[model samples]
Target: MRIKFLSIIASFFMVSFVITSCLDNDNEVNYSPDATIRAFELDTIGYGVNYKFTIDQVSRLIYNVDSLPVNADTIINSILIKTLTTASGIVTMKDQNDQDSIVNINDSIDLTKYVNATEKNNFLVLKVWAPNMEVQNEYKVNIRMHTMVPDSLSWGDKPIAENPAGITAQKQKLVTLGDNILLFTQNSDKVYSTTIPAGSPSDRLNYGQSWDSKNADLPEGADVTSIIRFADKLYLLTENKKIYNSNDGLTWTEDNVLTPDGATVTNLITSFSNSDGSNHKNVNGIASVIEKDNKKYFSFAEQKETGWNITTSTEVVPAEFPTNNLSADVYATESGTLNAIVVGNTQGLDSKKDTATVVWASEDGKAWIPMEIPSNNNCPKLVDPSIIHYNDAFYICGKETKDDAKGFQKFYTSPTLLVWKGVDRMFMLPGILPPVKLEGGVIQYPYSEFSFKGKEANYTMVVDRNHYIWMVGGQGIDKIWRGRVNKLGFLIQ
Candidate 1:
């Protein structure tokens, strides 16, 4: 009887141990945080590019939501998307007469609202909301969230709507005006002012040079390509084939600097590639003006050489400037590529056009030799390239042309201009895939557009001290677009 009693106690102890172990395992497996994603489920949607948090169970929400790291109990009291979307929190659209069609912020088709377990794994609802704005029909909208928590941000997602049909192209031109009022002269000669302060449109601003309105005007039959204001002088290249230099914005002196012998195509002297007056010498127009180490640089198309070249000025005068060969493409097309070139003034890099790929250096800015890119990659193929320097790095913007008809904006970054490989910072901006069709023939209205589809060019980038990148379009109208790299990624300013 005593042995039996002892056995019964041992069995009871084993049962208790098993039950305790099972209970502990259950508790561990069901571990929950006071602040799970379910706490204050945030869902940033589009009225514009901003975050919209959906209040969950967290009564006292906490987050440092202004692009910094988010923490607990941080309240996102308000979010203002600097957009046309109304603050009433309702989405809208336009009718045939260009009137508003009201819709709930939670019901628009282009917009989406959702909650995430974290920023990573999220659930999506079928409907969305948008605002009724004119530009809303012109651009595609994308919204994403960034969280302080690791692996809490959303991944690659498409914009709410495909860009609608319209003339989204902005007329962009480079002009030097009084008091540094850089003007983007429209094709119709209508000037769109830039950040350059407005002052008298006098020839004295450019010294004695005349901005001969008719002389440096857009090609008689083409378009106004770009203008550069370097040093005290202003240079303008017209699509109709002319290069005009002016000491002031009003008075202009015409020079066929690139023309072989200054051939008069329709009475307008086209800028020649060489002094011999070669019509086929230069194909494209002069692009951006870059100044490095007290030297002024000009980028343009060298048609005869079948590539692009960069010319530098030892003096401010266009006449005294010595031209050097930059990068030349083996092929050329209207669908041609432009590489953005930025010279490092303090970066101690060399100044060769073809060898400007960062890794290669020419201390004197002339004689260049081939060097290996660290990645052993080929050079980038740029069509209509534009460049800007910022924060010790050169950012290049150009259009990547496919063998097919598709083209889009592409970018690259390097500490030096030489040794720029295909591998660099690459980004595609929000632009139309279809090219805008323009009118041809008479240079007067040569800038005509088709009613249907057209693609836009990548932007010409200019970086300011405030780190804002000012961009102007290539073939379209002159509208200035600003850009910057922000916490939410790249924002078109």
Candidate 2:
């Protein structure tokens, strides 16, 4: 078919008088052949067989010369030279193996059918149609063009003649953050960080063997829940519902952070050692942690036969208390209650970890007591907490959820450094909740970490200087899930 198409175009000029005259009057017409005349003429075919090719519905804008005359083709082989360059971005012969990402726009969209012998001389258009991408401002589309003759092809990237190319090339964006914030992502088993000064380009560093997916046992469906850097260690929470620990931000050692049962062997959730740098105990499901008065405290969600439970522990196991002393004051009365907790580092009257007024203390790991405060609705039940020592107060930050059927993350702050009961009124933070949506006759809500309904989970936020928040394991209907802030960040949006 291609051969037949070129033969017709070649014959069009066979009868033209200019060709015969140029040959006979070579001595008389000594001037060089006009470039414009040759450019407009169907003369040079790039040293190949003059196969017949049919060009259908050629648009007017794609002509070789400004004033080139258009000849009607009632099944003519020659196509009007659209651009000065003969390389028609339109691909003709595609390798069946060609998987050029450009050609893989929509699953149902067949790019093979778009391949053809000729185009009106224009690059193909690509459109994205995935349901998740339909409304997103940032999306990707794949496209592929076929170039048959190797020498005639003048493309930077061209597919082989009969085989299809791989089209799974995914697109990624380079994000820039302000000076105070450093951004990074975990690609496979390695951790990569790009630090951007307030207004400058990023300085990137890649740490090998820093993070592993097997550490957290990340849920079966999604990649990972969350990762953050706290203290000095590079911690990673995996989808496998486990926590991975690292010291130098390179090599890692993982331990069972959380078991399906409530038993734990470590007292330290995350520790910023004075000598060893940042590190976390090989424990899982702890959400957030913070330090104040040189002491560290951690809060996490654990599974129980009754329902989900939230508990807190200090980094050091006191000589008096050999076991991890969990505060007994706060407990969800019924099952199916989701809770998260984190210590706040902010400075205030009630912000000291050791000297705070009302402390939820337990001398022995067996007994629990909430001293100096009473439980009331004024105290918001926290689900996931981010505790930090900011300013002079030990701030306890957490996701305060509504007590009704659905659970959500509501940012709240408390200045009281004491136990859960003595804390000050819960004040909501400004501008942080995920947007909600109504789809498929159901109200779909956005969760920063776990989704009980959709069973989808994603973790955000950086854990200290190197670690990130990592959340793992959540059944579609709110079963077992353990999440913690780790050292590694994520790239998937």
Candidate 3:
């Protein structure tokens, strides 16, 4: 009977122990002190995922490295921030108007008020609290946006620089040597060069550039039209089929560039620009050539350590290939095919008047092909044509063969390098328009589009490393204009 009573007492003690353990588990409390933000998620549809933000836990800062687009302000008021989770606590943002009171941020938070107060800068008063509300941590954020429509190009009232050559002469060529804009003037059958400070219109006006003439030993009658840069030296084909290279802008040296046994290079085409037209240096070029047997053909001028290694193409120059006033550029197609393109004036044998600007292309620099100009999409009869690969397309700018030389500028662009269309709005030139003048005592309205103000025959253009278009026109308007597409000139973008 005593043993039975002891057993019942032991069972009662065991049941009591189980009940005590259940109560302990039910009343458990967390005392973690760490409070942090695990991720700060931005709305993907609006921001487009490119505006990546970096979180600096040490400095307690969250900001984007790249300035947001111009439209960032569109959603600034109701910017959707999908969510901002925390490592701990009930996430809370200090009340914008009353900092003393806090608003619990459930799934999303409204930061527009805070952003406005701090001017888009994230002054993160964001706090993650421990569950007991005893410990807390704070973070700050910053936002940046572009001030203007980045892609729209704007040319401030006047030329960034004018009359850089400081010469009254009307026949010259503009070229760039690194940062310097050099103009080679035609002086008594000999060409002399002068360097001018080249910069944007945003730079100080009338840079008071000194014209340092580099005219010690320049070759006589060097066709400024035929001058092209290859490697580190500037080379020009003279009237007599002689090739001369210059180290300095002046001192000319005769480079015995070997052609085929009986072939002679007539014109130096152009050094190939990169496929994207961003770079046009240290590359090979093309040469329009003729054999001693009176055969017209083209050849390739390969880049070399010292000079060009001329490779004669087996094919003959097409009958329509331009003979003079030519501008050419070699570029790679998307599929990596090398295409050499040339545009110039072509006139019939008995016709004194020049025909429309003609275009020719070659794949291997040997076989030449003419791109047929459609009647519906015909180009102007340009006297002096210049072509360049820019903005994923080719642009051709030149003067018409019409007399007067006023309001005769023509600018055209081609995507497939086939159909040409006149450019407007974006490239319509303000610099090309004439100033309001008196017509029979009545004030005349300025025409919408025109060439640089002059009867200039010699005009040269270059797209600089920074993609600024530097144009120098000779004949009358001996001025230099530096302009760029607004976005291309942005510093921080």
Candidate 4:
């Protein structure tokens, strides 16, 4: 009878112990703070749905807690937010709307109200916390005044009929005449003009069936070197040292007064009053650089009441500009109130020894002044730099070589043509593909001439009114490509 009593007592004690353990387990709380506030989960109210917000619209910043553990009781109090302007190194703190006060989970903060008006592209740092003032997590948000990214090169339909000879006909010159884009072919004596249609995609070049070809008044087998627009007329300079002008791109009139005698007109540049009337005091004239009898001459033609008053300047003679050969590759453009010219000789052909690339600038293109090379350490020796004045700045694009191998193309921009800043290489367009190696290891692209020189020396780029960059035929390649520059100066696809 005593043994039975002891057994009952042991059973009762076992039940009591199990009940106490259950109560302890149920009452346990996880205070480890493993909850995360993901950046992607942050909600943006107003403006657009994307994480990127524009400064023009009012935006609300909030965090969603749906992804957190359901049984984890996480509490969020206040968010410490700060903004950093990208263009300018300016920092601002979030002070509006009692943002420093305590806030609950899913509470919102007005972001646009705290952002300064001078802030352009910016980044936001949001430090979230729990009710006990313990930091929860931090997130970064990108804000911009403009959301459009740069575009990549978008090739259009062949402006000309493909040559039956299987050779890609070279497009020697590309110029924007008013609202039309004029193209001059090296192998054909015709000029093709097209207009970009409105509402076209970034990768689409609107080469509508409205292509117009005019008989470029040139001798048979002569190639066009440069094309420019001055005084509401389009001018074409050819290899035969001739100048032709047309009020409309269809008709042509030879301007013999501006022609150089026995010299090839290698480059032509013109500056005019800005259409927006921002630069009304600037001169409206045309300038051409020609190589004659082993001499380089700067020819300036000032716009007159009726026609052009031509003047010739011999300041850039061969004695002063000692290029290897008289036929140096010259590129010219008008930047603000200055006319800048870039001259470089072909490597291994015209330049037997290493030569420094030269740049010259002039207000009237008569009294030329040499520009100092940029003092930046990263500024490499530019082989053949292409200069263009687009989007209120002068851009020089070229390639730098290291250990005899061509590096990716680089771009430098200057606001006043005096100081240059090397932009990031990401702003450069896609480079040409590597050429097939010949028996002697000579590199040549398909359908290209058997030569060692790369296409960097022969590229022609032009910027339209819309800031769309149009690349003409490069060395040994007749295909065309174009891309657009965004406000942030990035080149995007």
Per-prediction TM-score to the true structure, in the order listed = 0.34, 0.26, 0.70, 0.52
The candidate maximizing TM-score is: 3
**Cα-based RMSD of the predictions, in order?**
21.3, 22.2, 11.7, 16.5
Instruction: Give the higher-TM-score candidate: 2 or 3.
Output: 3
The CA lDDT at 210 in model 3 is 43
Pairs that clash in candidate 4:
150-492, 151-492, 152-492
Q: Which 10-residue window of candidate 4 scores lowest in summed lDDT?
A: 68-77
Q: Which residues of candidate 4, in runs, are more than 4 Å off?
A: 1-171, 198-222, 259-277, 289-297, 314-354, 373-384, 391-393, 399-403, 413-424, 431-458, 474-478, 488-493
Query: Looking at model 3, how many pairs of residues clash?
Result: 5
| Error at 321, model 3, angstroms | 2.5
Order of the predicted models by lDDT, top scorer first: 3, 4, 1, 2
Error of 2 at 378 (Å): 5.5
Cα lDDT of all candidates, in order? 0.34, 0.28, 0.59, 0.47
Please give the lDDT score for candidate 3.
0.59
Candidate 3 is scored at a TM of 0.70
Over 4 Å off, model 1: 1-172, 175-188, 196-226, 237-243, 247-250, 254-376, 416-459, 474-479, 486-493
lDDT for 249 in candidate 3 is 62
Highest-lDDT candidate: 3
Q: Put down candidate 2 lDDT per residue, 368-470, tens digits, no spaces.
A: 2333344432334333334433222333433333445233333223444443332311222211223355676664533333232222221122222322111
